[model samples]
Target: MRYPILIEEGSDTTAFGVVVPDLPGCFSAGDSLDEALDGAREAAAAWIDAALDAGMPVPSPTKLEDARRLSGYEGWTVGVVDLDQALFDDSIERVNITLPKRILRRLDDLAAARHQSRGAFIADLTMVTK
Candidate 1:
């Protein structure tokens, strides 16, 4: 998925700013164009993840041409950030894994303490680490 982003050019004394129009309130900044775009990608991914986790629908990206025509952002440079399609996928699949008995026990204990299922606990941990 390629999401269109608007970048405000930066000067020596300022940082570049980027905004992901598809995802409201998702924005990022950096000292250079590359850094700004990278930050935008991360911001967009995090925005999608949070929306999915909260049971909210993630908006599809508006076409680059259409996004460019939107009001405001007049003079900002336009660019596309290619996001992994998997970021928008929320399907669940079952899998089997082998773990040391002690580790399994500890995992179960931690999950129980959090009042979450083992799978839920693992998923939460994976997201945090990512």
Candidate 2:
């Protein structure tokens, strides 16, 4: 999804801030505009990951015009972040990943406790975190 981001310019006393209007609580900051935007992408992904983990419906991306209509956004720079298809992709593609036996055991136990398969449990964590 292409989510619109608002970049609030900062002066010498503060850092640039980014806010993803479509995703509440999704924000980031950096010394420069580029950095702030890079952080915003990561923030957006984390937000979606958290929502998915919580079993909540992922909110649709707000239109750019609608997002800009929100008050208090005057003079803010706008940009769009194109998220990876994997965030919404349902096709299964398997690969090998090596992990410590201890950690693997712990993961298995946790997945079982949740009444979920190890792959699903791991996929949720890895997708959000990676």
Candidate 3:
């Protein structure tokens, strides 16, 4: 997804500031335009990750034109950050992890008792523990 960023231009004495309108309270800063943009992308990803991990719904990105038209963003320059769609995807992906045989056996047994695969069990446990 392409999210619009508003960059507050910086001079030699100040750093560039960035804000992601779609994500409330998501902001970043850097010494240059490129750095501000990079920081914004990282901030956006981290924001999304935290929101998803907490089981909160992410806000959809407003169109560039709409974002630019926001009342307070008149003088700031705009930039687009392309976030990977996979970050928002819930699709399963195969992974390999090695565990102690006894622990693996216990996990499998518990998973079977709960009618869920070990991966699903582990995922559920992780979310709950957090």
Pairwise lDDT winner, candidates 1 and 2: 1
Which lDDT tens digits does candidate 3 get at residues 55-118?
A: 8999999999988898888999887889999889977889999999999999999999999999
Better of 1 and 3 by lDDT: 1
Report clashes for each candidate as comma-separated counts: 0, 0, 0
TM-score to true structure, per model: 0.82, 0.72, 0.78
> Native-vs-model 3 lDDT?
0.91
Best by TM-score: 1
Ranking by lDDT: 1, 3, 2
The per-prediction CA RMSD against the true structure, in angstroms, equals 2.6, 4.2, 2.9
Best-matching candidate per lDDT: 1
Give RMSD (Å) of candidate 3 vs. truth: 2.9
**Candidate number that wins on lDDT, 2 or 3:** 3
The weakest ten consecutive residues by lDDT in model 2 span 84-93
Model 3: how far residue 70 lies from native, Å: 0.9
lDDT of 1 at 107: 99
